[model samples]
Target: MIGFFVITLGPMLYSLYLSFTDFSMLAAPEWVGFDNYIKLFTNDPKYLDAVRVTLVYVLVSVPLQLAFALAVAMVLNRGLRGLSLYRSVYYLPSLIGASVAVAVLWRQMFGSNGLINQILDWFGIEGMSWIGNPETALGTLVILNVWTFGSPMVIFLAALRQVPQYLYEAAAVDGISRWGSFRHITLPMLSPIVLFNLILQMIGAFQAFTPAFVVSGGTGGPVNSTLFYTLYLYQRGFTGFQMGYASAMAWILFVVIALVTAVNFWFSKYWVHYDD
Candidate 1:
């Protein structure tokens, strides 16, 4: 606990204070109360763009990821042969999804001369560079984010396993179809896990950096379509040399994530069912 406070809490509080200053990692931090935060809302359109991009990413990616993960989990739960091998294969993407190599590979894969375009060419379809097009650049990042469904799938599998078989047995006796049983019994029982995965993925989506960074070449290029919140924060802090401004952005993101998570927890009372 003491170590956590010192290592984690200490930097957090210090950074919070820094958010109100005008530090450029040069000579000294000048005290400028709320200037950075005020500028973010009033003067900076790019910051607002980042906010919009981040919200779209979180809203779009998390649901698709959860849905895909749940579907995969349900299929795998049906006692497939060679389960361990298949499980590892599915889980591999999530493990390396954020790696620099994978991001670079995705960038290449979505380029005009890459695998996707090559496949399209085989079908006599003209291919455009996905990562180079403003419309499709962000979409590629979303696809990359969705591809790592293994983490939530594993959690869903575990939650599904914990569900009492007696409920399903009883439901079957009462002529409940598979869909009906899943909708009523399985869904209600797995609600807690769903809530858990939602919160985690939402936070992660807001903090997504690698795909945009690598795919967009760290500039959120093609008209800033992929300017994720974290990437912008990083650019401001490290690239633009505005540590204090970046700190302000970080705190704002922290607040946004906290409020979103709080809202989820609050709404969970309506949807999330606990067996207790």
Candidate 2:
């Protein structure tokens, strides 16, 4: 309890105080009374752009990632041979996918002379540099995010296994189609896990930083296409020495995530189900 208060609570409270003050790390923080947040919401175009980019990323990546995870989970639940081997193979990416070194490798793979474009060359088609173009830079990051679906995939696999086989047998006897069984039986049963993965991935997407930071070479570059919210906060606090403003941004992100999570929990009563 003492350690938690000193390590977590203390720094958090200090950071909150700093958010309302002017602190550049070199000098003592001078109280400014909401100036940082005012600048962030009223005067910062880059901050606004970061918010937009982060929102798009969370909304797009979370759903697509969950969909991919669920689809793959359904397949793995079908009792394929070498199930353990395949699960480990698929989970490998999620284990190291978020690392800075992996982000650098991803950048290289999408570069002009990289593997993807080289494959395109085989079909008599030219490919543009993925990370260089503003239009596609964020898209590349989204694909990277989706590629790390192994975590939720594992959760989905566990949830899939918990589903009683007798329910599926009943469906098979009823003349239910494969899609119908999934829609009526599998999905309703899996909705709780789906909501779990959705909430986890949504929070992760909003806090995502490394892929964009490393891929954009710490500049959020190519016209700021991949300027994620956390990356922007890092640029402000550590790089730009605007710690107070960055703290305000962090708190704002916290509030947004908290509200979204609350809304999800509130709405889950309508969809998410668990057996009594």
lDDT of each: 0.93, 0.92
Judging by lDDT against the true structure, name the best candidate.
Answer: 1
Question: Mind giving the per-residue lDDT tens digits that candidate 2 earns over 48-116?
Answer: 899999999999988999999999999999999999998998898899989988899999999998999
Error (Å) of candidate 2 at residue 85 is: 0.6
Our model 2 lands, by Cα RMSD against the true structure, at 0.8
RMSD of each candidate?
Answer: 1.0, 0.8
- Which stretches of candidate 2 lie above 4 Å from their native place? none
Candidate 1 residue pairs in clash (backbone atoms < 3 Å): none
- Worst 10 contiguous positions by lDDT, candidate 1: 21-30
- Cα TM-score per model: 0.98, 0.98
Candidate 1: tens digits of C-alpha lDDT, residues 131-211 = 999899988888998999999999999899999899999999999999999999989999999999999999888898988
